[model samples]
Target: MTRIVVVTGGTSGIGRAIAERFAADQAEVFVTGRHADTVELTAKELGVHGVVCDATAPGQVSSLAARLERVDVLVNAAGGLPETASGDVAPLNALLAQWHSSLAQNLLTAVLTTAAVQDRLTSGSSVISIGSIGAERRGGSYGAAKAALAAWNASLSAELAPRGVTCNVISAGYIADTNFFRGQMSDERQRTLVEETHNKRPGTVDDIAQTTCFLASPGARHITGQAIHVNGGAFTTR
Candidate 1:
């Protein structure tokens, strides 16, 4: 039977790629995004279902759960750097705002969405959340939130393991494509990131998508509650 997969933030970036990958594998893919247009368009493009959902909103998340018949895999990919609040605030206040936004965007989005959909998850289900290398170094509030995500996944994995559900976080490195840079990536910065990677290349959305598919496959049944790094050896912890 074809698996039923849900990908939050599936309209763009890693989430979009993951959804497409699952669809290509003949799975029934449902993707969620905050924007209705983008979500609908992406769903049409990938031949998957799309729902407009802001994972941070409790009511919406609850509704989303009710709308799903089943969720064999949940990819919590809705997260990003905090947007600058008010755009005109002082540096200190702006930083604080960014911190709160980061927590909301990265950590709470996953927590709320997963809690809302926990019941819909069936046996052998997998929950994959996108993480970042920033959580390890040169990271600020965004990293902190991702770190919290990883921590939460550990407990969640244990709680869901008896039911045959698995939880894992993909700690991605510098990935190209998507609006990740917000159109501000300088050539020098790109080169620096590439040089840091042992492979001398940046990561692609497909790289993450393939890994997510593998995690959800039966072959990964034994894996749970782990953070898999996919940064081309940019950061290593042995």
Candidate 2:
């Protein structure tokens, strides 16, 4: 049977790469995004199903869940550092807004999306949440949100492991050619990031995408509730 692979935030960046990766393997992939145009364009380009959805919205998530019978692999890739709006709000209010945006995008999106589609995830299913190396270092609210994602994955794994579903986080490091930095990364910062890695290079989308596929494979059945870092040795843990 063609596996039903669902990737949230699949319009661009790491999510798009994952969607492309699975589509190449002939999976019946369903990709979701916040906009209709990008989702439709990406779906057309990748030859996969697409849904316009805000993963943080419960109603939309429920509707997305209703479209699938079985979700063999669920990749929660719908997160990023939200852009701060130019406003004259108080400092405290602005700070709270930033934290709220980060949590909603990086953490709550995964929580809600999983809860909605979890019933369709049967034996041999896998849940892969995209995490960041910032969680290990100092990443401000974004890092805190990613850290919370890893924490949530631990509990999620325990709850679903008995049903043969595995949950894990792929904590990626400085990936090249991604919109993740939002065009704000300076040349010096990029160079420094590459230099710090043991591999002397930034990670690629394929690095994480390939890992996601592996975790969903039968061989990775025992590898649940773990944060697999893909940071070219930038950060190491045993």
Candidate 3:
């Protein structure tokens, strides 16, 4: 049977790659984004279902869940550093807004979406949430949100494990070929990131995408409630 997969924030970057991977395997893939034009364009290009949804919004998340009757896999990839959160406001208010935006984008997105679609996820299904290496380092708001994501995944895994469903977080390293940095990443910073990795090279979206596919496979049945780090030895746990 073709698996029914849904990827939030699937319009571009890592999310797009994951959606494309599943679609190529002939799964019934649905991709979501915050913009209608981008979502439609990406859907057409990748030949997957597309929905314009702001996963941070409860009403939109619930509506998206209502549209799906059954789901075999769910990838919560809708998150990024907020671009507008850094500006001229009172120092305290600015800090508060930034933190709020970061949590809403990175953590709450997955939480709300998962809660809305929990019923649609069937037995033996998989729930994969994308995390970041910054969670283990100086990520500030973004890092904290990702750290919270890992924490939430543990609880989610426990809740879903009884139903034969698996939930895990993929903590990725600095991956190339994405607008993740929104044009703010400097060449020097990129080199520094690569140098930090044992492989001496930046990671790719495919690396994360392939890992996601494997986690969703039956072979990964016993893997639940775990945060699998996909970084190139950048941040290893002892």
Candidate 4:
């Protein structure tokens, strides 16, 4: 059967890679992005369906969900660094704005989208949310929002697991070929990030994409409510 996969923020970066991977596997992939042009271009390039929807907006998220008939897999990859707003202010005000923006971008986006599509999910379906290693380190506002995502996933898993649905979070570290750094990454910083990993290399978009496919497969039915780290030994847990 052709699996129906829905991916938010699927126009670029990790989300784009994941969507392309599923499409390559012959899945009926549906992707969403904030821009009409990017969404249409990506959907055409990947041979999948695309919708223009901002995950941060409830009405848009609801409209996106309405477009889906049934979803076998839902990947909440619609998140990133919040846009800079109102500069040259007090340090406290700046920090507050950043925090609020991060919470909206990283946390609320997932919450709203997931909630909007929760009923459309079928048995044996899986929900995957993109998290960050920043939640475990000096992530500041971004980290806090990611941490909240994991925490929320725990409850969501418990709620959905009884119905044969699974939910989890993938906490990535130092992913390469993404617009994450906005082309501002220095060679020294890149080297330092690579050096911190025991594997001595940065993570790739393909790595995360493959992992996502596995997690959504039948073999991973027992895995739920867990934050699986894919940082190549950059951080370890007991």
Judging by TM-score against the true structure, name the best candidate: 2
Which TM-score value belongs to model 3?
A: 0.98
Give the per-residue lDDT digits (tens) of candidate 2, residues 1-238: 9999999999898999999999999999999999999999999999999999999899999999999999999999999996585768888888888999999999999999999999999999999999999999989999999999999999999999999999999999999999998899999999999998998998999998999999989999999999999999999996
Better model by lDDT, 3 or 4?
A: 3
Report the candidate with higher TM-score, 1 versus 2. Answer: 2
Question: For candidate 1, lDDT tens digit of each residue in 158-204?
Answer: 99999999999999999998798799999999999999999999999
lDDT of 1 at 168: 98
Question: In candidate 3, which residue pairs get closer than 3 Å at backbone N, Cα or C atoms, i.e. clash?
Answer: none
How far does residue 97 in candidate 3 sit from its true spot (Å)?
A: 0.6
Q: Any residue pairs clashing in model 1, and if so which?
A: none
Candidate 1, run of 10 with poorest lDDT: 80-89
Q: After TM-score superposition, what is the CA distance of residue 173 in candidate 1 from its true location, in Å?
A: 0.2
**Which of 2 and 4 is ahead in lDDT?**
2
List the global CA lDDT of all models: 0.93, 0.96, 0.95, 0.94
How many residue pairs clash in all the candidates, one count each?
0, 0, 0, 0
Candidate No. with top lDDT: 2
Residue 124 of model 3 has an lDDT of 87
Alpha carbon deviation, residue 211, candidate 2 (Å): 0.6
Order the candidates by lDDT, highest first.
2, 3, 4, 1
- Those runs of model 2 whose alpha carbons end farther than 4 Å from true positions after fitting are none
Candidate 1: Cα lDDT at 187: 92
Backbone-clash count (model 3): 0
Measured against the true structure, the TM-scores of the candidates, in listed sequence, are: 0.97, 0.99, 0.98, 0.97
